[model samples]
Target: MQKDIYVVGMMVDERGSKAPDVQQVITRYGDKILCRNGIPSPSRERGIITLTMEATPEDYQRMEQDLKGLKGVTVESIHFSQPESFQLCENR
Candidate 1:
């Protein structure tokens, strides 16, 4: 089976209310994550986090479900596959 790339976006409206919990869950799935970036709102009332990963369907679903359970947090994900003819110019 071909592996897929997933870009997950999380928005938390309550600042640090659930950030630690979300970070814990992300850390648990660190092996599957390729990149992670988080930015806090200037007012510190909200935060935006992005995670790029490659994981099995089961693992992906589990992660999504875990994130969705957090209060004041909204999660969204996009999945795509690289074209067979495409080639990576550098190793990750």
Candidate 2:
């Protein structure tokens, strides 16, 4: 199976009740997550979270399903592929 590096964004529309559920799912898949950042909206009714993750396609879809099962939560992710080469001196 091919592995992927991803940046995921999660939105919580009803933070009061939904945030806890979101946290639970996030914790369950914490091993696949490399980094996490969360911010609350100005009104405090909603929240936004960003995650950096590395996993196989199967694992990614499973995690996505878990998060999407919660009400008022939406998940989006972008996959990043490895570069063939890096030239450090080219930018100069």
**Candidate number with greatest lDDT:** 1
The alpha-carbon root-mean-square deviation between model 2 and the true structure, to one decimal in Å, is 4.7
Across 1-92, the per-residue lDDT of candidate 2 in tens digits comes to 45678899998998878887898988988998889999976678889999998777788889899999888998999998644363213554
| TM-score per candidate, chains pooled | 0.82, 0.81
Q: Point out the worst 10-residue segment of candidate 2 by lDDT.
A: 83-92
Task: For candidate 2, give the lDDT of residue 65.
Answer: 94
Instruction: Please write out the lDDT profile of model 1 over residues 1-92, one tens digit for every residue.
Output: 44567899999887667778988999999998999999976678889999999777778899999999988889999987766455434688
Please estimate how well model 2 matches the true structure, expressed as its whole-model Cα lDDT.
0.84
Displacement of the residue 25 alpha carbon in candidate 1, Å:
0.8
Cα lDDT listed for each candidate = 0.85, 0.84
Question: How well does candidate 2 match the true structure in TM-score terms?
Answer: 0.81
